[model samples]
Target: MDVQQPLALLGGLSPAQFMRRHWHKKPLLVRQAIPGFKPTVGRAALFELAGREEVESRFIQHKEGQWLLRHGPLARRSLPSLTTPEWTVLVQGVDLHDDATHALMQQFRFVPEARLDDLMISFASDGGGVGPHFDSYDVFLLQAHGKRRWRIGRQKNLALREGLPLKILASFEPEEEYVLEPGDMLYLPPRWAHDGIAEGACMTYSIGFRSPNRAGLAHEVLLRLADAAVDEEASPIYRDPGQQAVAGPGAIPAELQDFARQAVQHALQQPLALECALGEALTEPKPNVWFEPAEAAGMLESVVLDRRTCMMYDDQHVFINGESYLASGPDAALMRRLADERRLMPGDLAKASDDALELLSSWCESGWAHAGLSG
Candidate 1:
């Protein structure tokens, strides 16, 4: 994508301009983000995805002014009739299941792939909605079919209604409203509360970004670091030779606390250990994602990483699907290109070191990559 060139998706603003002006700062309502947009996945196809065991989905219904929610692996028969009013079926990660959906997501690669999460589709009958709620991450809500009336606010009161499966705003104070038609889009920042209700039967595509909370992200990184540390060193267990009587057995000892801190410090101290752990954590595949191993190696004239595979690299390491490898020299450059472009030509691989070529082959064998013309 040329940052200098204006985009129809961002209402004639360049990706750089959109990122600088509206990203994470305010809302943007593009009149026709995708002109004459049609859903890549139809209603029937979305229902099929909701039925798949590996896909994440949800069913919500609002009847007689009451809100209800359900988890899915829902069958077509289980879903409410198309004529049913005030019901919705939402499927998460549609990009993972459909090629067209995946391609649609790629258009938004102006955002770093690490932050770019999944593309979800929400289908609704008349007046259907999940209720007024705020997300912890940024999102682009693109209307695909029919129309949706959206009520949004910069919610100051984040309290939720108690005793509900869904985290609905107890006191929703909508500051703005709009009726979005097909091809229209709304961009929202984290914690900008919004509620979208179907004017009639409608489909909306949500392009969401992951904003990992500081503490939760720190915990995951530390766990990965600890795993790497264990493989690198066999530290001795603490032995209390001069035992001191404890006043309370329930209390954690100061010595044990220090040992825990030291353990984390040691992991952080290792050269590139923190970087390795972070890259691995960011590139880790979703728990439900699984790939079948390749039966035999094929031609390697060109190669592309599988859509389900996650690949990323830093200055010293390349990470793919939760594993990390040290890379340097020309091999490092080659691997970085693979990570960026997600495809490598025959000539590109010809310049790779023996170690890098072997690694790419192994990735193919593991079903993380395939040898052929990339889509």
Candidate 2:
């Protein structure tokens, strides 16, 4: 996308302007962010998706001054009637299940793919809400159907109500409020408290971004680094033949501690090892995601990545579905384009070397990609 070009989605601000002025700094309320926007997944379809074993979903209800939350495979019969008040059904990762929903996510590609997370759709009855809460990551709340009244504030006190299943703010203080119709969108920075109550039956789409905390990120990276070190052909083993016996056998040896430190440093010293591991970890599929294997086809004309496939690239490697491949020169350029565009045309494929073709064919066979132009 041209960063300088203005977008209706960002309320007439160019991608560059939006990133500079509002991203992680303040809120943006865009009227008609998507003109004439309609729900990508209808009510019935959403409920059906929630019932699928592979999908992550939740059911919440606040009735008679009591709050209830339930994990789903929520059957249609299990849901409250449309007339029921103060109830909601939330379906996570709608993009992974529906083509149109996935296409809708493409609008937000101005952000780096690495930071972009999944889209969630929530359906609610009259007065329904999950309660006022703050998210650790940024979110774009777009109204897709009916109307929702939103109360938002820059929360200072982050305390949550005790003994509740949800992390609802104990003392919610609203600074602004709005009633959003279809096509309206509100962007909130991380830690901004917000609550939305349905005026009637409504559907809302949330586009969220990944914001990994330091400890969680370190945990993932360290595990990948250890795995990479183990896969090496010859890793140095700890040697202490010259060490003297210690009187305190319960305590770990100082020499052993030094060896452990060196081992981690050695892993970090490998050529592009940290970059490869980070890329692979970022592109790894979620736990519930699974692909249907496809038969290898001869003479590929075009190829598109599977919707569930997560692909990314760095200077030295291309990462997909938790695996990494060394890439450079023309082949690397082509792979990078595939990663960016998520598809390659016949003309693009014609430029691929024999090895590249073979690799793409393997991806297709593994169901990570398909042999057809993306619609």
Candidate 3:
């Protein structure tokens, strides 16, 4: 993708320009961002997905001037009548399960894949909404079906209503409002408070970005570093015969303190530990996700990566789903192509050496990738 090339999705601004001028700085409302767009999952299909154990879903109902929310594993009987208004069912991470939703998500690859989260779909009746709230991460709210009236602003009052399951803003101040039609989109940065109400029946797709908190990142990285450190056979101890202890018996010795600091430094000194940890942390599956291994050996002529598989690369290693492998030569080039393109075409896979083919077949059997047959 050309960052400098103007895209209709960005209201004709180049991705570079959009990032510089709009991303996280403010909100952008793009009309017809996806022209003639339709929902990837129909209402019935969405309801079906909501019933599955693997999917996370919620139902919100506003009736008789009261608000109610329910967590799902919902049966069709649990839902409101089709003719009823002011109800909604929201499904998170649709892209991980549905191929069409996954394909739709790829259109936003101009954004770094590592930061990209997943597509969340909301199906609502008239007046249905989760309520006024702000997200800590950036989001692109695309109107996939019908219409939604949105009121958004840069809110200062972050106070929330007490005793509610949802974190709803108690005092909302809107500076802008828009009724988004099908294909229209609104991009909002973190802490930009917003609310959307279904004008009638509506479906919205939120393409959210991940923003890992500093402390959370440190925790994950340190855990990974410690795991790596445990694997090292040599356990060096502090040696300072010339050093004198502090006067207080309770005080820690300076030499031992230095040794502890040095240990931490040494753990971080491993050449690619940080990089490996980052890839692994980002690719860590949500608690409920599980993969079943495939028995078939993948075709040498072509292969396609699984949607849940995360593949990334650095100078000396290729990382996939929290595992890293040293990469070099022709095989490295081929694997890097697979990471970038998300699939190996027949021609591209044909270029792989026999050893590369064997490695790819192993990956397929492990459920990381699948055979892509030739026409």
lDDT of 3 by residue, 1-375 (tens): 778999889999999999999888989989999999988999889999899988999998878866789988778799988678888899999998888999999878888877898899999988889899999999999999989999999999999988877889999999999999999999999999999999888999999998999999899889988998889897886688786656788877877888899999998988988888777777777775666799867356678888888788878888887777888998999999898889998788778888888888888888888886443
* Tens-place lDDT digits, model 2, residues 254-298: 888998999999988988888988998899999999898888668
The best candidate by TM-score is: 2
User: Which has the greatest lDDT?
Assistant: 2
Worst 10 residues of 2 by lDDT: 366-375
Error of 3 at 333 (Å): 2.7
TM-score of 1: 0.94
Model 2, 88: alpha-carbon shift in Å? 0.7
lDDT ranking, best first: 2, 1, 3
* lDDT tens digits, residue span 1-375, model 1: 688789999999999999999999999999999999999999999999999999999999988877788898989899888889999999999997887898899889898888999999999999899999999999999999999999999999999999887899999999999999999999999999999999989999999999998998999899998777778757868767766898888898788888888887887998888888899899999988988788556546778888888888999998999999988899999998898778899899879877777788889889999876333
Pairs of residues clashing in candidate 3 = none
lDDT of 2 at 61: 98
TM-score of 3: 0.91
User: Residue 180: error of model 3 in Å?
Assistant: 1.2
User: Which segments of candidate 2 are over 4 A away from where they belong?
Assistant: 373-375
Residue 30: error of model 2 in Å? 0.7
For each candidate, the alpha-carbon lDDT, in order, equals 0.90, 0.93, 0.88
